[model samples]
Target: MIVSRGTVAFMFEGSQSEVLTEFLVSARSLSEYRAMFALSPRDLAGRDILDCPGGAASFTAEANRVGARAVAVDPIYATSPNVLAEQALVETERAVAWAHHHAERYRWDFYGTLDAQARVRRAAATRFAADVRVAPERYYFGALPSLPFADNSFDLALSSHLLFSYADRLDATFHVKALLELSRVARQVRAYPLLDYLGNPLDELVDRVRKELSTNGITTSLVRVDYEFHHGAHTMLVADRSN
Candidate 1:
């Protein structure tokens, strides 16, 4: 999420236990969640939200408090909260170090400086950890390209950074399939900063995603957002499937 795309950050530890295979970073703090998802209190009112790849963001914690039905699905939730908390702290430190070393690679228009970025991430993680202590069920252990939910399960589904950020690693077929899965469970899906991890646009993949969705009776569009930490990466793809 540091490449001017969105705030979905993850560290790859390769496959483990022959079962644990990938890490999907969704640790963007609450404020970062707002910027990355263009979310507001109004946007979540009385809606069921699915945060796919929900690493450790405070969006679900915050949203659930306000009467919104929010659920965070990620592979990390399968582990013990204590373990996830420890791993999250390590990753946060690593991310902060990266931002400090490669400040120029980020836009800083929203977060301002490396110090603020660290603070936000730390705070978000803290909020997330606390919530886990009280309500662990809010965080579900799961992965994408496939979701375990009934059709029309949620009203808003938020997937940031991952799908397009790893376009090269995840081929066009994976992108289309993942979007379709998200579309299946949620009425509306919003994915931001439609660019690859290198701050480069995934033009072919983007077009293909929209085209593939359209063929399935879904409509997609790139909507301009208020937040843009990466230069030239200022839009989010909003897709709506017919009921």
Candidate 2:
């Protein structure tokens, strides 16, 4: 396993299909996993979207279901905490069961919960193509950053746990830089700043996100999700396209 910023990225040498099959089997329930898709703005139909820090592609599947071309970019491949097989199994199990639980909400056509899980696993195995050489902030285009991307390459970009997890450990400026970089790459961005991890107020963070977008001459709308099932307050900022 290779490590980066205290996270592990693993690589798998066998066929991805075999690895994905086992992942589907362990995905028994949709508990914590439901939160990922539950918060996505359903209005984004027909829009090209990007799920940055896309863990197991839960958001990626949402975008795909909505008829949008979606891409998932994360550094998990570069920093494997364990073997790729283990990570794939764990993440796939979490993600598929979540999807299966909300099959009705997503209007999915699976015959049963088991079928839904199987479908997601098959889809991931069939479509999971990621090149570790590409930089993630570059909109599905290059190696993990330290390298940035061109401006306005994406319609929507989202991260579930990116900046918030780095607060006390990293310099304040570094956190700001990553957020700014994410805003730079995306025309519209939605981010769930993990509350338990960063302890930053959701309102304050949305204001900061708004200010960051404003600094770049873009208008932004920030919606804070506050619901019981999604107990954690997450910030969803949508930047208006200037063109």
Clashes of each: 2, 12
Q: What is the lDDT of residue 176 in candidate 2?
A: 49
Every candidate's lDDT: 0.75, 0.45
What lDDT would candidate 2 get against the real structure?
A: 0.45
Model 1: per-residue Cα lDDT over 1-243, one tens digit each? 111122234433435221112333445865666777788888778989998877777778888877788998876778788777766666666556555555665788687777887888887777787787688878876677777789999999998777887665678888888889999999999997788755788888899889998999999988888877667778999999976
lDDT of 2 at 171: 40
Q: Which candidate ranks first by TM-score, i.e. highest?
A: 1
| Model 2: residues with Cα > 4 Å off, grouped in runs | 1-42, 79-85, 90-149, 194-213, 218-221, 226-235, 238-243
Model 2 weakest 10-residue run by lDDT? 20-29
Error of 1 at 232 (Å): 1.7
Off by over 4 Å in 1: 1-26
Report the C-alpha displacement of residue 214, candidate 2, in angstroms.
3.4
